[model samples]
Target chain A: MPDVCKAPAAADALLEEERFQALSSGEAKIVEAAASRIFPTTDTPGAAEAGVVHYIDRTLKEIYPKQIASYREGCAALERNAKETFGRQFTELAPDQQDKILSAFEKGTASGLADASEFFALLRKHTMEGMFCEPMYGGNRGLVGWRLVGFPGQQFGYEDPYINRVVDLEPIAHEMPFSQQEALDGRKS
Target chain B: MAARADVVLVGIGAVGGILASELTAAGLKVVGLERGESPPYSDYALKDAVHAIVRHALHDSARHEPIARRDKEGENTRRRPVSSPTNQVGGALNRWTGQSNRFAPGDFKVFTQEIASGLAERAGASLEGYNVADWPIGYDDLEPYYTKYEYEMGITGADGENPFAGPRSKRFPMPPLRDTAKFVLFRDACRNLGYHPYRTPNGILSQRYKPPMPYAQGIPERPGCVYCGHCNNYGCHVHAKASTLYTHVPAALDSGNLDLRTRCKVFRINTSPDGKVTGVSYFDPAGTVQEQRASVVILGGYLYENVRLLLLSRSEASVHASGLGNTHGLVGQHIMAHEDVRVSGIFDDQIINGFIGPGSVGGRIDDFNSNNFDHTKLGFIRGATIGTSGSGTPIERYNIVPRGMPRWGADYKKYLTRYYTRSFDLNMQPETLPHKDNYVDLHPTECDAWGIPLPRVTFSLHENEQRMHRFLAGEGEKIMQATGAAKVWSAFSKRGSRWAGGTRMGTDPSNSVVNDKCQVHGIDNLFVMGASVFPTMAGYPPTATVAALTYRAADFIRSQNALFH
Candidate 1:
């Protein structure tokens, strides 16, 4: 219906306070903290500004309802390391100390976890999906991920095989190819 | 519940799709059984990378219907999973990458030309414990059917360009898809290296096509591909990809004599004491067991299910004492698949724009495929089909990332920005030789949610195939370097797709499960179809050959006038 008209409700929600589907207020803070350290701020918006935590929160409710408990366990793992090493919960730890805990989890050398690597992988995968997935899935707010990677954005079809030019168009957030407007849409706003 | 039909076609994917269309067109009443229901095709054409590519929403779930996997006989079942062909009405054809290629003529005579003629010996390749057999029928016999399938299925390619291709009856029905940056780079590299490269043949239509078949003309017309990068792992929003779901399945449904039954899981092939199949029993959508009696039966499921049906059909003191065709002990032998490997290259000066085109728009060289080149002193008999192809979605960035770059942090973000749009990968699917060890059998303990014993695939990369993959990855690196890439890395994965073979066809009943006619040995009315009958698979994707073989087999079954009339 309105799929073609470029519905702006998703964009408006980015500026306002967005509701979490699965994660609680405290859990959201924990995930947003980890996602920020995982893909922290640089020249462009990182996971935090891109609302990656919101993506993880919704994905937990939608596609991965089974992993909600594991995600809570992962949050506990982060807090355990933070309290042991830095005397704080994960959200309250400094970015450097948080990075240490996450990097350790990634390397599978972290303590007080059953499968740190698997949890780290899950977090990393969801982080990437949130960072890069089209804004329709509640991530990549403001098309920051597409812009950072020069991905142009989703196109139904490319009339030209070498359409690398910065062409603004709508990303097909729903099903099917929604047509390529010279190239994938790298609309920054 | 009970039903009756002249012919019962099990597994309404590629094989059954063709058989259902053909038998019904010939005026015989036909019933087709499929485990999964058909969805409106265009409904899945969603280009969502997270759902379509990363999550594999279009593919069958491994949690429920996983083919138990073990590397060798004694090893525990490993977590290594081969992507299952979807259980839906269209089968794997629903989501094939649309690379429509035919095996070289030499592929059919591997035993005579490669082994007996001393090519394998000359290569110093051992044939010990290999289950290789010369296909009873060769390329000449299937050429007409290959042409028929191609035209009917709307293949798009310049036929004469592939110098290694067997004699063609006609040009491809449509012109090939447009060449993108990746193809231009790969093609230029091949030309500079003095290798003959051809535009990849594909089932995805390049132009608005009206297929030559009378039956095909009645189905909805197909529009030309719009160069949508969503072609891989996603269905086409438009009916551009020539899947039987759009082609033959619709053709079957259109034929008045056919009954297309979806969500029906066939459990066993009912056979009389005389060893001719009586019919089949299956679970309907409501989980109620139903029987269908027929004069002729076809086992046209994917290779694993094709083998499992015979294994599961056995009962105490029944016609099948061991398995249906296991008197020869070859019902589940010589299972073959690709041992695919890859190499990725990063370009600093130029953006490849790899995300712009469908996976089909690339250059491929057949110089290394089959026996096109000399294998003298080489450690392997079969070779690989090497090409640069794939849609450059964000997920593929994992493969092309600079080796030491972390998956997280500021450096990773910069790496994604720099190399994401400027990288390309050259992938190879090496031809797998039939091996004694690389086979599938019914799992001893595992069962599905329906309590059906899961088919276990006990396959490992054969030493010959492993050696071939190693050499080919080196060649892929060389090709990538020829593209003038700034940096190159090996992105190797031993996992292959489209596991074909298990119930192989040969002339001798003592060593093979079926004959060239695709009829089970010692059983006149029972036929087993698809790539499961492949004695040796070529390096190329086998869908085109599967369609060709099914076309030929359908003709053979139609000639049995007694059953039809």
Candidate 2:
């Protein structure tokens, strides 16, 4: 098995086709651009660096198939707005120009296709989910989101000694998911 | 063909799970019908945010069987695609936050006290439209069963710590769990504000506990809570959270007297010509129709489903034309839900570590709960329990930003990074009075996958509850300011549906579906359990009370076993 933490390039190459399972290549690019604008990479890694597009892609395919229509229509509208405003696709626009278009989407001012505000809200919610959710869901790569927000993920217990004390501790991400089944199974026997 | 049992229990959740254990122990074979699958211990092992939060893995998917809702009675109810109560074997208990609290003395006698004190008249809110009535049984009646439930379920708490709590027969099964820094801060803040702060009682275990007597043998010994910060909205992987799935259900199964049929959705209760329930008709997992005949039928389903089942069973040809136990057209009336008001503050000076404990592991002040405070002067009759909880997971905390902060983009990210560990929410779980209009009824147009009409909830916050909310929000703001926070803000002002009442219990057969013993009036063998039997929604969480009532019902059934024949 490939090391998911170390081999970013290999993992990216393998899941390339799976990333566009619901969306076309063009649509995928639009989502990627939109996600970056929602949680852009500033001094730290935002949604784009956290593999939010991959997360949304996989979720649309496996978890939320019903949202595909909204995403498609939303992306189409976003593209229309981008072209109508800046004479460019959303993916090709400058960061500042992209921000302006996203602002319009946020305010429900951008018009052209299907429900612009609804689609913007969906993307924003999914972007956040991808950023902070456990890394097992294909986003929050290397637990960057956890580190950035100072969250210690899946720490099983904090006893009396550490309970009433406030300590500024660094974020430590668990390699394996906290298994309810394993804990329960171990006790059942 | 129909399967036969001594009792048929619908919806094996908090109440049903307890009933199954108690009745099976009393030598009555029970057949429990659960609409969802019996999730294995392994299923509890993972607390994936995507599955638990995003997809709502534990709860029944609204997409499969949506619940319709409308604020007004005349308005067309639309399908609410999210938020249905849980349906699995353990039911909502599987994913409950486990904030177990006993209803205060005043909770049972609110309506009576209101009439005596003349607060209802003074506030210009008459009891005319509001069907709020005093419970036939008081706190003393359920005290022993409350003690029994606590010890049986291994609830950890500093008993009698909340001076405002009703008299208790015994201490909590275990001592309170260790407090976090955030709770300590909140407790100190409460003290500074001249309020009594105590450990919030919860069903989650504080330490490894072996249950006593009959329940001990079959149930696995549960370890102490690890403070995984995934208690609410997530099942316990470590068997630390005392869900019915891990407690009562296992004991029932161990007795070899319970036939738990998972994925069997009971659509209708069958009754004989003499106004007696025969059993129930349900759709099995494979969509095959099946029947379970029993001497006694217990509807232990959630509050919404209980009302829906009764309304659905009503037909012009049936004995219960109005509905089961609807002699006065009262089966689905007087529904109530708690309105949660939240006040949050961001502390820039200290790291509060908001994600450190189990769901109910926090410091709470019951000084404002029930009628403990001077509600005579206040506009509202009842008040809320002000508490500070540390159940905020990473995803939930991400959304908590200071006022005027943009919801998304770079500034929002910065806000989360700065305040996620520093902010703490002070919540008020306020008591909501039951109204004649707020209720659950069968939707005319919409139906579930089984072609059964969906339950439509018609609920709106009454003026009484609205006043109570505003007062509680103001109190919360005071507490937040007392904490010396850099910034404080009220996050929750709107009332969301918490869902209670419908098939409520009382002394009168004319108004209530069930009697004090939870037996459906005029139908001796028919019963309803859970919060559905609660006439009013108390400020406290209802699961522990639901369990106690179930135990009480089981005891009543065992005593009246001769009538089963």
Best by DockQ: 2
Clashes of 2: 6
Q: Which ten residues in a row have the lowest lDDT in candidate 1 chain A?
A: A180-189
DockQ numbers for every candidate?
Answer: 0.35, 0.37
Give one digit per residue, the lDDT tens place, for model 2 in B1-565: 7557899999988888888888888889899998877877545455656666676632444456677888888998877754436777777777888788888888899878876778767755534477778899999999989888888888888866788888888778789988776687788899998999999888888889978774446667889888877777778888888877888888899999999999899998988877788889999989999988999999998888898888777767767898888878888888888768888888777777767777578878988887787765466677788898746666877766667888877788777877777878887788888887888888888888789898888888877887888888888899988887889888664545456799888998877889999999998888988888998878888887888898888889999957567
Estimate, for each residue in B126-189, the C-alpha lDDT of model 1 and write its tens digit: 6667878899999999998888888887888886888988888888888888877778888889
TM-score of each: 0.93, 0.93
- All candidates: TM-score of chain A: 0.77, 0.77
Worst 10 residues of 2 chain B by lDDT: B55-64
Separately for all candidates shown, the number of backbone clashes (residues 3 or more apart, or on different chains) is 2, 6
